[model samples]
Target: MTDKNIIWHKVLDDKKELPEGRVKTVTAAHKGICLTHYKGKFSALDNRCPHQGGPLGEGSIENGLLRCPWHGWDFDPCTGHPPGGYDDGIDTFPIKEENDAIFVGLEPEKPHETTVSDIMVETMINWDVTKVFGMVGHSNLGFADAMRRQEEKGNLNFYGIRHEGAAAFAASAYGKLTGKPAACFSIAGPGATNLYTGLWDAKVDRAPILAITGQVKTQVVGTGNFQEVDLVQGFNTVAEFNQRIQRDSRHAELMSLAIKHAILKRDVSHLTLPDEIQELKASSRAKAKTSKNRITPLTIAPPKEAVDEAVKLIKKAKRPVIIMGHGARNHKKEVVKFAERLNAAVLTTFKGKGLISDDHPLGGGVLGRSGTPIASWFMNECDLLIVFGASFSNHTGITPKKPIIQVDFDPLALSKFHQVEVAVWGEISRTLEIFQEEIKGETSAINPRNEIAARWKIWKEEKTKRLSETSDKGISSIAIFEAMNKVTPENAVMCVDVGNNAYSFGRYFEPKNQDFLMSGYLGSIGFALPAAIGAWAAVGNSRPVIAVAGDGGVCQYLAEITTLVNYNMPVKLIIINNNELGKISKEQRAGEFEVWKTALSNPNFAEFAESCGAWGKRVEHQEDLEQAMKELYDQSKPSVLEIIADVNLI
Candidate 1:
């Protein structure tokens, strides 16, 4: 072939790398070529076997004929012919050997054409979806390539994680923090299925997320094709918007609706891209859709009657407590203001731990099972309950017997589990604005700051006494978190796992404007590390990102530490090592059953983190905690601080 418009790429540096009678695969200008050394000469032939698209380079040379590995088809060792009787033959490429090096020449790569993936990705980016976390595989190459182009243009970023489950969790955390949809990409079958837990977490938490999965060729979809699964049907339960992209589908509109559903509905949206259809050329008339004029502001106000009822209740409430849930994350400032104006004690659900700063006079610590005495005392004594954006999950234990006024943007979320005295359907901040205006500074509520302070002092005394509790197994959980609470950045974003560690953190680690993310409704383990990755992606290096996990939960996504290292994300990971599924063991004991199969064998996680090119430290004694934590936190890279703690002490 003529050399015009050709690019020559080095295939081998030494001819001895491939011994005689050996065939190896190499890529020259993005085309796979099987380089063969037979009879003291070199030849380059197409790597595919043509019949089954098997890699001919993996085949063996027997009887001087290179045999296809899959179906045992034979081909000429030097020529591109299959055999004497065969009509199908592969193409040959120009290969030259000079100075003990082999080179293959091919025509320069052509400019990429706009494909369905390009259109969809453009639409996704136009809607301000700036981050995607996942692995790139053969089936999702087209979509990954489109994302690569966007990355080059500085439009978005793609983080290749160790597992698809981590990708989903990371995306979910990003959405939860920013209220914008971040996507998670995966290939067909197992990769797509691995995203289940994280997607369910986002769905139950009302976080906006988008999931993209590849499928086998559309023509072979139902024929039991390799790596094929009915992704649309599989994602139906987790996603509010699930669709399969087809060649005739309106590509931009599909992406628009996917993000729209995720944002407006505050849930997961899923899209399945078939392998073959991903590369189909887009029509010239098709243009990517943007968010301009696409979405409406959701600042609706509550009905006048509902506002009047809320006002009347607040006027007569002598002792009122305002409870904030994760749903009130965005409107916490307004909620805090409302609490101050009404002189009501402010309590937060476990998920809403940091909504009101613990230092605030009226702020009471988290309520329910993972709560402090201050919160529980307020709940028992308060005559009026004003719930802002809380779902009243049993975990929060908002009393059903008390007269309650619940406000939420989503009408369905108000009084979701039981009946309340008043359900005000409106945006949280907007509703608070109306309530403040209608109340007109007329109220019987007394300031509970002194009582809240007294409760905190009592709780602190109790916690201090518990910190002295010792076990031969390890240090106390209180000690570990106490060190963290002293040194950790006040504005840090904390991602927590589901276990005794999380409960201890909720109980001991007082919040001071720090935000917390967890798998609230799903209560999935191993959420901390991946969620920390997502939080890092959202905030970059501007804020600290901390992940807290128990021994059992950290094992689920341990390899993700390498992902953090690869991305240079300086996330601080704290693992409470009790060497068992401590929570499950406690549950078993509570049910009067023997603790069986809950114990775990663990490696030295601090050493493992060091091996992964990150900083690490192990804290075994309470006296060593603050120093070790300081060392771990001082590292300007990804790090792990493993603390040996007593499970029972929690």
Candidate 2:
């Protein structure tokens, strides 16, 4: 079995298992071997048919000849020779029987040569982009195998997902948290097309991500082959850099450039690999490229004049509020420091829910539609708006009429919606540093902490009143969030789906040091579970990952719960089963249309999770919510806690 050239493989099918005149396909050292038994003797032949790639083992032996399942080509069963000794024939391997056990002899597999896929994958690894979520298929087998080798070498982590869409969402979430690129892989046609929604999410949210797709063979260009689509053109609208990997392409440099674009631009970069080009041998002297000096530090400070004007405007205002967005995720310390020094109230956009702790004195919750009254009151009362890294999306409702100072790293994002008093173009952390240095003395701003506390008290009283309300239809969202507030770890990372549940969470769930991720601009449903998978990859168990979704949202990627179980990722998921698309229904009524086709017929998700080897529980009432959530988190595995709530309550 350990010989150098003729390595023996144990077929595991003993002599009794093979009847006379029968054949069965078995794998030997990763090669398929068709074992045939005829005339009280056994012989091993190659499993594949030479003509149409059919499984010869699945064919039957009739009239002393084996026939191919596809085209019925006949060959001598004993020697694997075609009728009349044709040049085309199947190869035969030596077989032996010892003590009624079967074994086949085959030459050891040839060492893999350096191919284009191998070089590209290695370059991606060298750039420290390790996480890949995707589905592997026929067109992408070469690239998948390359990744497999890299994974075996401990250089990459590839998660094979049930759906390409989930892979994209997971990669997007990883980029949002780490400010780096994670890859989503797919095959040609439908597989590649499925990634569009999640890729758009990354693009609009300014999260860096890489999308790798497979294309038809280059020889079939514009010939309309099966499952073929122009992936480069398809991906152009969603990707910052989109290209097709062709033969003789600059392999390693291409990968480096893709990674560079994703990270530096904070956008989606895509690459399409043709079927045949993926396996082409690379040049002998080719080497993987790295990100050693390609990226420079993003510490650009705003112009001195812009900073002076911003500080001057701050000094003249009585009440100044700081609005932070997802872009300021990493510079939390400096943003909070500047707010405290100026004695200004701080508000966060919905996507920036946890940028600052809600427990902080000056912290006003989320702004705009999915926001608290506390934030709305502060924004309305503030005379000056000092915005940092926020996009001023209509969802956030940052008033352009007010005197504003918007600081962003992207010059294009400055004054994107309307002109502000000062539009500072600089990196968030460095610009906040300059702001703190300039405003060393006390300003005309009032002690807003007392006012913030007063607003929070008023909101909490209303929330308490909502929480105690009972209904026969189902439990209120306030009560569900109240239970979540009790059990959720302060340091947990939450991935929220778009729905009324999101609105309720923003209004009721007080975020404290927890980082939040969502489909901020695209507002896609079904983002929660897959994004949690991504979050788990980023922070692992160091910070618990929680996904929040409504019934409609969870159903989109309901199968992904098994992905958590497969990877042993302990992601706690909360499903608010309201029995309908509550948000859409609300919108329909608001538009003065008859509500139709929004209701959902749901399953017992708790039992479904148990079937998938995960801990699960469903709570139908407020009294059982706390116990169910506690039990869900107690287990050291992926778990689901489904809460049945009233649709109208949210």
Please give each candidate's TM-score: 0.98, 0.97
Candidate 2 residue pairs that clash? none
TM-score of 1: 0.98
Please give, for residues 386-428, the per-residue lDDT of candidate 1 as tens digits: 9987888888888898999999889888777888999999999
Off by over 4 Å in 2: 1-4
Error of 1 at 367 (Å): 0.2
> How far is 33's C-alpha from truth in model 2 (Å)?
1.7
The lDDT per prediction is 0.92, 0.91
Write candidate 2's Cα lDDT for 1-650 as tens digits.
Answer: 44667988889557888899998899998899888999998999999988978999899899999998889999888789999969889999988888889999998889889999999999999998999999999899999999999999998999888899999999999999999899999999999999999999999999999999988899886899989998888888899999999898898999999999999899999999999999999899888898899889889989999999988998878999999999889888889988888889999999999898889998999999999999998888889998988999999999987889999999999999888999999998898778778977748988898888898999889888877788888889999988888888888999999999999988788899889999999999999999999999988889889999998999999999899999999999999998999999999999999999999999998889999998889899788988888887787999999899999887
- Model 2 worst lDDT run, 10 consecutive residues: 1-10
Candidate 1 to native Cα RMSD, angstroms: 1.2
Q: Please name the candidate that would achieve the greatest TM-score relative to the true structure.
A: 1
Model 1 local distance difference test score: 0.92
